[model samples]
Target: MDDRLRERFAGLWSRTIGPTGAEAAWRALDAGYGAAGRHYHGWGHVADLLAGHDAVRALPDFAGLDHDALALAIVFHDAVYDTGRADNEARSADLLAAHAGDAAAEAVRAAMAMIRATAAHEPGADPATRLMLDLDLAVLGAQPPVYAAYAAAIRREYGAVPEAAWRLGRAGVLGRFLARPRLYGTAHFRDRLETAARANLAAEAATLRGGPEP
Candidate 1:
């Protein structure tokens, strides 16, 4: 990891888990991102989410948010990612509960809740949840070349799956995103990300469906 990201985690860990535990957590998260077969969910993904969070944080609605807690959540949201498992968020949340300070319980709780909501991403009433989910989904709005690379990286992570099954499953996911009335949860994101996301998803879904991407 770069020094800035390393130092960001360093500050978070030192404040929440102290120097020793912070060191350990830092090593674990850094190593986790660098682990084998994590093309899509690694450091690049975290960096994107961090950038999205920064963009959203500037918005009037989220200006008063507890950024520290959300930052913790963003870094660790996919900390235990396993493409085949449904428990990654829960496991990641468990890791946070074990390491974070008692003073952070409320934020941790909110973060964990937001992380879990990524599973279905159904409509939500909580403002924090909306922003968190939207930030994570911002990758959908990336320019075509970037989105294509993102798709390829994900396919790499699921390399074990047979091509036919991967096609069906991946198509289902893209179809669902297309089905959503609005891919973004926040108005800010809807304004900024929705159009590109729609184009990307439609193009991907076409490719997955045996048609040429638009």
Candidate 2:
């Protein structure tokens, strides 16, 4: 999975990070994505985001955004995922910063910002940031079975926690998404995914609370 992703990144950023530097960064990121307990936040997630990005990258509104930064951010966003840590985003940002030394200054900065924003999936005013968030959370709006599989994969990742505790923690996270004025940040995603995402989140939250799902 990462081999192809690595190749794509190498091809895309060869000018900025150079071929050798790109190879090194890919090696580091490949290992990070292969980290233990990364059931959902692993290569599959990166692949999904990359595939989604391809669909939108050519869109006129997105064509001007920093493709290199967005691509790098997608790779590093969950690079530091650990079941025990709360600072995964910060750590991931640090990892990207450390490994992306040869990338352009602005590109690296953009990558770090997008990576850090994943901590809360906060909405941002800018189209670039909005697209990043939308791509990251696109799975929330996936078809029912796909979304269910994603939910289960996430539960497996947190298997260390007792069921009751995990339920409470996960429910709180879902509730916050529910409380958001909007789940999707970009107009493209908002139009295509918002309703499904809200329904999926709300239904899962209800199930966690032992109530009927909507």
Candidate 3:
């Protein structure tokens, strides 16, 4: 809860979706998905991604884009996340439309498209989308303790699933993450964190497979 982040969120709230509506929407989302619920992809996760995106922006050669739109997208990326639901994106889009009006609604839809596109690791996706997706998955490259906590949070979010099913599903996700050429395709992230990210993913994958630490 940095002051700058709070200010930024307030600005984003006032700009796209009027202050009152944004406040209400955020409160609803916060109450439903905040830390108390142990939601892995909640406000804290969005805040982390926003911070990563800002860090990326400071790198040389980073072209400026629609910061507000991207910020809004990040906030709502997991707005409708449900471990048992297959239509999270659609549901998120609907919620954004209802709460934020038409323009913000469209932005949410685009964000949803970007999110779904990342699942396939599409080669032709836009650079902004790539960066956003990478930031979303950046937890995988965090320090072991941080990553372990993230893993536990995710497990809690998906607690409805049986342990065996959760393990297999999680392993499949890590495998897909490993298949990517670079976790973050942006030049800055590739230069600074790619090796460490790969090592982290590899270690996690090994642990998932019940192998000794690397």
Candidate 4:
């Protein structure tokens, strides 16, 4: 959220997504999703991911390209998120095409592909995709209070599910995350956040099991 980052994000919006349409998309995101929904994967999430991306600048042979496209992808990645539906990516892609036009449509498609690749939990995927996925789930390693708030917000987003169902489903999701060789594929994140993320996941799993809180 620094001025330089904000300016970069703005530039991405203006050049890639169009200022007018981007503004409209922002309005739609804010109004349609409400504040809590926004917190789940909104501007804050995009900013966090961008910050994480910036953190990996020391990687060798990291020739940055099409950052505007990546930025657009981050912005729209969860644009149509719905807990009840399994095709959020498709819906998000559709919305991006409708709102941002052809170039953004392609970017959205590529971004969705990258997002879906994370579902495999493989360690050997494209480095950028791995980094992006890690950033998306970076909250797993956040301070307890922050992670707790995010956990509550995510639960609220899926309020229709019963507590038992939510607990089981969420534990399954977190288990998959913990099963990965590294919580974050980037060397920086692997070194700095991996242990914390595993600890957090274990604590969350305990809570899901109705054990004592951490």
Candidate 5:
């Protein structure tokens, strides 16, 4: 699977940025995502995002989106993830822009915006960015077992946090999402995932708060 993903990324780089720095960029990506402390925000997560992008690219609803730009953005969105950092998205966007150089300037600009959108998962003014946010958050609406594993992986990523602080912080994060009127920004995702995502957030928040799971 990693090999397949690496191939896809290489093809994207070649198409978007020519041959320059492609191999070095992939090596950077492999090392960054394969880091020992990365439990969730890793290569597997990148693969999932890319797969989701591929699944939706052909849909008429997303026809106006720049699919290639979205693909590049997805590939680099979490390329600099760190559990303790607040600027991972910014750093990742900068990294992509640097590697892309001046080639595909429009696409790179769009992709950079999309990459930054993951920082808050907010639906900004751009449709492509909204979709990117939705893709990053699709795990929120996963089936119960998958969602459980996702949540556990997140916990493991932040394992250095003391138990009490972790619980408080985790519950706070879930509470913010639960309080939102809609978890998914795009209508396609909202229709298909909103209910399940809400239920999952509520249940997880309850568990984190020592209340009964919903």
Candidate 6:
């Protein structure tokens, strides 16, 4: 899977910034996602996002989506992740913008916006943006065991946080998503994963609060 992702991303990067830059960009991406202390926001998470992106490319709604820009967004969205930092998304976007070089100005801007929007998981007017956000959040709708593993990985990422604080913070984040009218912005994701995502969030929230096993 890692090798496949490398080939896919290398191809996209070559198209975006030329072959000369693809090697360095791939090295940076691999190092960033493979960095120490990353339990959840790692290469595996990026791979999942890319898989979700590929899964929906055939949908009519995504026909107009900027495939290259969306791919860039997925690859760089969490490239600067840090549990102790609040500006990872901003930094990640900046990192992409720096490496974008002479890539199409519009595509670079669009990718940066999509990367930043992941901070709040909010969709903008663009269909690509909506799809990007949805793909980044696809894990929310994973099967119960998958979702449980994701939750555990996140907890491990924040291992420095006190248990009480981590539980409260994690539950609060889940509650905010649950409070939204819809967790998924794309109709495709909503139709397929909304119910499952909601159940997963609620279950995780309950467990966080020490209410019951789910």
Best by lDDT: 5
Q: Please rank every candidate by TM-score, starting with the best.
A: 5, 6, 2, 1, 3, 4
Q: Candidate 5 — which pairs collide?
A: none
Estimate candidate 3's alpha-carbon lDDT, on a 0 to 1 scale: 0.69
Q: Where does candidate 2 stray beyond 4 Å?
A: 211-214
Tens digits of per-residue lDDT for model 2, 24-105: 7777877888877778988989999989998999998687888777887887888888879899999999987787675577
TM-score (C-alpha) between model 2 and the true structure: 0.93
Worst 10 residues of 1 by lDDT: 13-22
Q: Which stretches of candidate 6 lie over 4 Å from their true place?
A: 211-214
Task: Give the least accurate 10-residue stretch of model 3, judged by summed lDDT.
Answer: 116-125
Q: Give the winner by TM-score: 3 or 6.
A: 6
lDDT against the true structure, per candidate, is 0.81, 0.84, 0.69, 0.68, 0.87, 0.86
Q: Considering every candidate listed, which one attains the maximal TM-score?
A: 5
lDDT of 5 by residue, 2-119 (tens): 5888788889988877877788888878778989988998889988888898889889889988888899999899889878889999999999988888888988998898888888
Sort every candidate by lDDT, greatest first.
Answer: 5, 6, 2, 1, 3, 4
Model 2 lDDT-worst window of ten: 12-21
> For model 6, where is the 10-residue window of minimal lDDT?
205-214
- Who is ahead in lDDT, 1 or 3? 1
> Candidate 4: worst 10 consecutive residues by lDDT?
115-124
For candidate 3, lDDT tens digit of each residue in 153-182? 888988888876776788888888778876
TM-score against native, each model: 0.92, 0.93, 0.82, 0.79, 0.95, 0.94
Between 2 and 4, whose TM-score is larger?
Answer: 2
lDDT of 6 by residue, 3-96 (tens): 8888888888877666667777778777889988788898988888888888889878889778988999899999998888899999998888
Q: Tell how far residue 209 is off in model 6, in angstroms.
A: 1.1
RMSD of 5: 2.1
> What are the root-mean-square deviations of the candidates from the true structure over C-alphas?
2.3, 2.4, 3.3, 3.6, 2.1, 1.9
Provide the clash count, candidate 5: 0
Q: TM-score of model 6 relative to the true fold?
A: 0.94
